[model samples]
Target: MAISKSQQFFESLWYRKTVWWLWVFWPFHLLLKLIVWLRRSFYRIGIFKSTKLKTPVIVIGNISVGGTGKTPLAIYLIELLTSQGYKPGLISRGYGGHSEHYPLSLTQSTSASESGDEPFLIYRRTKTPVVVDPVRARGAKELEAMGCDIIICDDGLQHYALQRDIEIVVVDGNRQLGNGWLMPFGPLREPKSRLKQADHIIVNGQDMVLEPDPIQAINHHQDAIKEPITAVAAIGNPERFFKTLDGLGYQFKRQSFPDHYQFLKQDFESFSGSILMTEKDAVKCLSFADERFYFLPVSAKLSKPFLQSLMEQIKAITHES
Candidate 1:
């Protein structure tokens, strides 16, 4: 799942302190800013209109490029809503998936290759209705048709085309806003100021905690994989996953890959011992995984105060509807 050397170099340049080389991408950064501003203006003045769904839509995403624990938060929200007699549905852009169709309603037989990793993993974990489509408004509509009382968008904070009732922006506690620059220059997809407009800002380590569950086997029994393991992650922040494993006192070789990487059987052909990965990566490897493949699952432990505030907002929205 490792990315190319050039990709590695660019990531390092973006997050780390490298001053002189940043000039190379300065022009592109300005252009991206201009485009972002124009898009927002269009949506603001009615030149472009956002599609508002009948059911309330809550978008959970990050302003930064890499993972800020959006999937875990989305899952937590789904569970929270379901416990209160609300039928919640999830919609995602399906970043790595190339489905033959749009607005795909996930079935139990759906594979990660078709519905994307996060959507498939969420559906498997929650047994809730999940839809994948590039146009999130259409996906939201499909969820509404499926009898969902509310919709949870996995990562579409800047997707202005889909009107959202509440926006929850998640930020990595350690990496706050890398270099505070946009796109090629830094990790931000939007400016840091955009966070001011969000309904709530959830910092990964502060507002919510990611508690790792018992590691489970992907293809066999829980005790199948032996010691001398190798943990791999194809997530936005592989180091974070490795750090968590270390904190849990598990010793293993570390392997990192580009985000949303399509894993193959040949990738693990060299490893002699057990292979461990994040639950997101586990979904993609399930098709070709062996007994040696295992995955670590993490659950979001949100603060009670935030939970109370969130439910209050949802109740207000429902009462209005």
Candidate 2:
């Protein structure tokens, strides 16, 4: 997971490690802003139509790059909807997957290489119907046909093509819209003003906590082997996983890769110690994982007040639909 110099440079820029040079990209950012405005306007004016599904669609996403706890929040919603006797299905863009066909349906046995890590992890964790398609609307339709009463989209805030009943934006509390500029200049994919249009905004690690489950062996069905651990993550924010491990008093060597990096067996061919990774990455490694490999699963712990309000909103939306 060695990062290229260019990637490192952008990381430094996005996190405010360097700032004075930010003005150099201001003009280009302004141009990008104009394009974004035009695109949104097209949708708003019906020039570009958004597909509305029969079931209520709840979109959990972020306006910035990098991880903001969207997947955990989506899983939380799946549990919430189910508890209310609603059958929920999930749809994703399949960011890292390359399946041979469109509208790929996911099951517990679905390969991460085909459905992508997030969708695969969600399916395994929730045991709910999940679909992946570059066309978000088409994916939602597939979920609807699967007998899902409601649909939850993992990350599709900017995907205006698929109309959503609820738009929940998850912001990284630690890096809330770094530099406040869009694209190459900063972390924001859209302007900060977009937050006002969202149905709700959840600051990750604020009202929510990622509670780790027991360590699970990747290639085995028992407890993880006790040994010095080598922590590796290919998530948008590897530091978050590493920090969680540190909080758990785990001392290990850190190895990070770009977000959604497809793992190969050869990547661990030379590793000698017990290796640990996130559940998202574990899905991709299952085909070639060994006994020494382990993964940590985490459940989202949302505040009661937030959950109550969200559930109420969900009920109101679904009732209307």
Q: What is the lDDT of residue 251 in candidate 2?
A: 83
lDDT of 2 by residue, 200-240 (tens): 99988898888999888988876845667789999878889
Candidate 1 versus truth, CA RMSD in Å, comes to 1.7
Clashes of each: 1, 0
Q: What overall lDDT goes with each candidate model? A: 0.89, 0.87
TM-score of 2: 0.96
Residue by residue across 54-116, what tens digits does model 1's lDDT show? 899999988887788999999999998999999999999998888888989999888898988
lDDT score of model 1?
0.89
Candidate 1 displacement at residue 199 in angstroms: 0.4
Error of 1 at 243 (Å): 0.2
Candidate 1 regions off by >4 Å?
1-5
Which has the greatest lDDT? 1
